[model samples]
Target: MYYIVGMHIHIVPNRGSRPTILLRESYREGKKVKKRTMANLSHLPMHQVELLRAVFQGADLQPAGLG
Candidate 1:
């Protein structure tokens, strides 16, 4: 069985291609651990990405406003 433990933002650098930032989560499938991408964050601005990283790291931040 696969169970997610936690999630984090990951940055993948390429030799000739543009870098990609992804939101990934750590999971355990049997005894081995693995990671899976939850979202692609490369399209978002750097500031927003930083905020999300902080939130994922357990930072205290205000809730988003409802529309």
Candidate 2:
């Protein structure tokens, strides 16, 4: 069966500290894209970098004014 996934990106800022980031996804069905499971992959080296790269690749980004 096929499923749909929704991606969300969050940016958090703290006073006197560097910003924090969070990436979450919602699955329209039971299935999930293994590569997007953030918790499971957070321990890896340069995890945030990897996550952003994967997110861009997974989501079909388009120009701001395009339909």
Candidate 3:
């Protein structure tokens, strides 16, 4: 049996501006690894970003304005 799970931030380049920050999930499918969008953190505040990081680190979180 085998399985893979992980999360990380993705940077998407923009034409003439800063790249967008996206939270992504990575997993293994058969012999290939794939990534999926989990959230977009470009517009989040620093504190919120920290909270999201905590959530990804297995902390219990409550939905406030993260929608």
Candidate 4:
């Protein structure tokens, strides 16, 4: 799930009504993990929309009713 500051932009993954963020990668102590570039989205006022755009870019992700 993408969170801008604090507001939830994308639903992440929903299970029965609860929203959860599933990370495909994990970090461990003493283990070096490849870190990717993290966009500093906290500075934006309209963060939710910006997060949504980031999540859906170049991907065919749409709501159930939207076509």
lDDT of 3: 0.82
Q: What tens-digit string does per-residue lDDT give for candidate 3 at 1-67?
A: 8676899766688999877879999998888989999888889776776777687788977677885
**Candidate 2 vs. truth: CA RMSD?**
8.6
Model 1 agreement with the true structure over 4-59: per-residue lDDT tens digits: 58999999997998789999999887789899999998999989999999999999
Question: Candidate 2 on 1-67: residue-level lDDT in tens?
Answer: 7666666554557699755555666665344344243433333355565656566568565657999
Q: Give the C-alpha lDDT of model 2.
A: 0.55
Return whichever of 1 and 3 wins on TM-score: 1
Q: Rank the candidates by lDDT, best first.
A: 1, 3, 2, 4
Q: Count the backbone clashes (under 3 Å) in each candidate.
A: 0, 0, 0, 0
**Is candidate 1 or 3 superior in lDDT?**
1
Q: Once superposed on the true structure, which residue ranges of model 2 sit more than 4 Å away at CA? A: 1-3, 27-37, 40-54, 57-67
Cα lDDT listed for each candidate: 0.90, 0.55, 0.82, 0.42
Order of candidates by TM-score, top first?
1, 3, 2, 4
User: Which pairs clash in model 3?
Assistant: none
Model 1 has an lDDT value of: 0.90
Q: What lDDT score is found at residue 66 in candidate 3?
A: 82
Candidate 4 — worst ten consecutive residues by lDDT sum?
2-11
